[model samples]
Target: MKRNSYAIIGSGALGGLYGGMLAKAGFDVHFLLNSDYQHVSEQGLKVQSTWGDFHLPQVNAYDNAAAMPACDVTIVALKTVRNHLLPDLLPATTREGGVVLVLQNGLGVEVESAAIVGEDRVLGGCCFLCSNKVGPGHIHHMDFGRIVFGEYSRQEITPRAQTICDELNSANIDAQVSADLGAVRWRKLMWNIPFNGLSVALNASTKEIVDTPSSFALADAIIREVHQGAAACGVDVPESAIAKTMGNTVKMVPYDSSMRIDYLNGRPMELQAILGNPLAAAKASGHEMPRVEMLYQSLQFMDKAAGK
Candidate 1:
């Protein structure tokens, strides 16, 4: 079987871990990094994972996409806030007929990439990973590392999507294909909407939020509201999804969500992509998610205030 070359556009925590795994498996993987470019280029990438510790002495690291080789699979692991750069990066890093896999969180993420690469060549991935960049060239993988791939604007699992999943599994990253992109996205939001926002709103970790009855209840309420919002948008998310998210979160490592870490470091949270877009979708269907709307408003205020 032929292996697919990969380009990791954002070599942050999630990107670094997955890209590093691919590189460790001897696949052709190129990383386009920003702040960690110098460190990773000089010292290689380091991963401290629960599975085990590994180090790549050298990697294909570049500071810009133009300098990187075009690959069969171009993975966009960028924070949705920096998605504006996709117009420049996607065209530069993706080869003709290559697919663009979007690994960012929240709804409607694949739309921008699809517009650039064409719908048939766009894939959205819902990542269920708990990892963070602790330092330059270093990623801490605390727990959970599974990704569900879904074809954009389609409900069938394409062969290309399955092939990518096979490659990811070969690299020891648990991956599978989903027929319904919208459903998978909403299922991810079941956890993201509550935990990401509440982590920042209450200055709490996953374990803390789960341990506190009040915060946990609020999180549960928000999850149900998200379910309704998904239904309003014509997506059927199972009730078991709510229980599954909460159950898994309870067993999760006590860790800071990506949004919380961004807040602590004075960086912008993914307020628009994660919350604002979902709210808009719900409202478009003439259904309102009051709890979600409230959370979104609070996050908006917090994000703006933190900018000052």
Candidate 2:
């Protein structure tokens, strides 16, 4: 078996967890860090996972992409708001013929990546992860670490996609290859839309929102609207997905969403990618998600008011 070397573009919570797991499995993994560069370079990476706690004493850490070696696979885990850096980071860290896997949330995320790396060399990954970067060089994995990914523009699970899935599974990470990228992305949005948006809007955690009747009802309505929007865009998301998402949330440990964390930390939120793009797509398909649009506007207002 050919082991693929990996370049982790955003060495934050998601990137650190996945890349740390790969590195722990003995694959060559290069991490590109920003603010944590100094800390990680000196102390290495730390992972506090539900499965166990481990640390990599020595790691291939680089502060700049140009200083890192091009690798077989480049996993992008940066927030959507920082996607502007992909154009430079993708080409710099990806070797020729290598693929780029986007592990961020939202609809049409692969579009920009594909435009830079070509559609065939790009894959979209929908991550069901509950983890956070507690401090420099430290990641805390709470629960759920499954990734469903597929080619950006293809309907078949290509060999490249399967290979990545196999590698992830080998590292004890639950990974699966999907046949339809669009459908998978929309299905993931069934949870992201309500939980991520309402978490900040209502100033609550996943359990708080689910435990409250009014908030839970709002979340349910938003999920239905996302299902309608997906249908309008020619994607068939099963109606049963609504119950599944709600049930899953009800069981998940009380955790703060990425969006809520960003807002509370006074950082920019991913309004354009998460809300703006999906709303535009639905509107173009002659569907209107009123609840989603209202949430979008409210979030925008809050973001501006906080100067984030």
Candidate 3:
């Protein structure tokens, strides 16, 4: 496979993890980072992963999209709260059909990306990794790391997608291309629906939320509501799948959720994408998600109180 230049829109934890690893593999990866961390790229990126530590010497970094060169694939890993800012990152310096991977956490990515870059060039993907930025030029992987995606609009699967899969697999990343990406995304949402909000509400880790009786019950209720909501939207999400998602919460112990981390740092929460979107879909399908609606209302109330 021919190597391609990769541009990462968000240089935070998730983007840094994938972008740094790709650059280490000798793909021409450029991270559109904040100006503060641009100096680290002058030398190179310092990736601290569970796989190993790497001081990639050949990594390219940029602070703005204008500085990036033509690329084959562009990874969008920004938080759901900043989904509106995506227009600034699309339209990369690449051919018309260049691959655009949406590595976001919620369901609206494909819809959102298609509006900006058109459906033909967009692919729906989800990251199954847990990572956080520990410092400038550094990302700490908390647990599992892999990515799965598929074309959502019946567009031809670009060689760039297969090449990226091979690259990630070669690096020991358990990457896969989903045959039914909507199902894959709904599965991912099963986990995010409960954990993301409960973690923020309790100010606790995933393990803590699952271990305690009250929090565990809250988590279960939220999952049930989400499953019903998904079914209402004509998505065939199984009850067994919902249980497995909750079970993984215990496995992902010691890991703080994205919402919890955002709340801790006083950043604006992604309640809309994480909670509101699913609730809206459920309502649109004439489904009642009382538990999720409660949680969503509480999060919105909290956000308003925090002046966020």
Candidate 4:
């Protein structure tokens, strides 16, 4: 398998977790840090994982994307709230024919990323990852660190995709390629729509939300709504998606959702991409998502209340 230098645009929890794994495996991974640049530069990244704990004493960290050399594969882990910076981040770090992988939560993300990096060079990745950054250069991995990748156009796995899978798997991160991008996107949403929203609205952790019967029911309802939205968009997501996601949540480590953490930090949550984008796609296909609509509207209000 071939490995290329990797650049991470958002060096937060998701970025640090995956990129750190790659770097530990000897892949040249350049990190574009945010506010944590100084801390990470000083102490490097310390990862405490359920699987194992490791520390990288030093990393190639840069605050400016322009300073980072063009990479053959660039993984974007930016929150959709900061998606407006995608164009600014991609052009400088991705070379011609380089793969731009988006490890994000939401619908139609590939469309926007593809617009900037060309569809043929774009691959969509959905991470079933449970990890967080405790402090600058500090990460905690709770459970579940598998990643699923799909070609933007839903084609068979190409050599590039296989190479990517090989690289991640070499780093001990389970990686799979999906031939159905639409189904994969909606399947990821089955969990995101419910947990991300309820976590923020109810001010609780994953365990708290799933342990409560009422909240669990609410999550189920959102899952059903998401399933319907997927079907309306001509992607028939099986009921197994909901069942599998629920089963995972039941066994997941007690944790704060990314949205909940973002809200607590007074940052803008990704309500638009996770809620509004799918809702628009569903409505365009003549289907309405009442449960998800309520969640979306409530998140909008909560976002405003947070002054983000």
Tens digit per residue, CA lDDT, model 2, 1-308? 77899999999989999999999999899999999999999999999999688999889999999999999999999998999888889998999999999999999888878989998999998999999999999999999989999998889999888999999999888899999989989999999999999999999999999999999999999999999999999999999999999999999999999999999999999898789999999999999999999999999999999986
- Sort the predicted structures by TM-score, highest score first: 2, 1, 4, 3
Residue pairs clashing in model 3 are: none
TM-score of each: 0.98, 0.99, 0.93, 0.97
Off by over 4 Å in 2: none
Per-candidate RMSD, Å: 0.9, 0.8, 1.9, 1.2
Candidate 1 residue-wise lDDT, 146-224, digit = tens: 9998898789988899899998999999898999989989999999999999999999998999999999999999999
TM-score, predicted candidate 4 vs. hidden true structure? 0.97
- Comparing 2 with 3 on TM-score, the higher-scoring candidate is 2
Q: For model 3, how does the per-residue alpha-carbon lDDT over 1-308 read when each residue is reduced to its tens digit?
A: 46667788887788888887777766777778774356566666677878888876546777777778768888888887777877777775444667778888877667777888787778888887788888777788878887888787863455656777887777667789866677767778788878888888777888888889999988988888888777888788767987787777777848888888888888898888778888888898899899888888988888888888
Q: Report how far off residue 77 is in candidate 3 (Å).
A: 0.9
Superposition-based RMSD of candidate 2 using all C-alpha atoms, in angstroms: 0.8
Error of 3 at 39 (Å): 3.6
Better-scoring candidate (TM-score), 1 or 4: 1
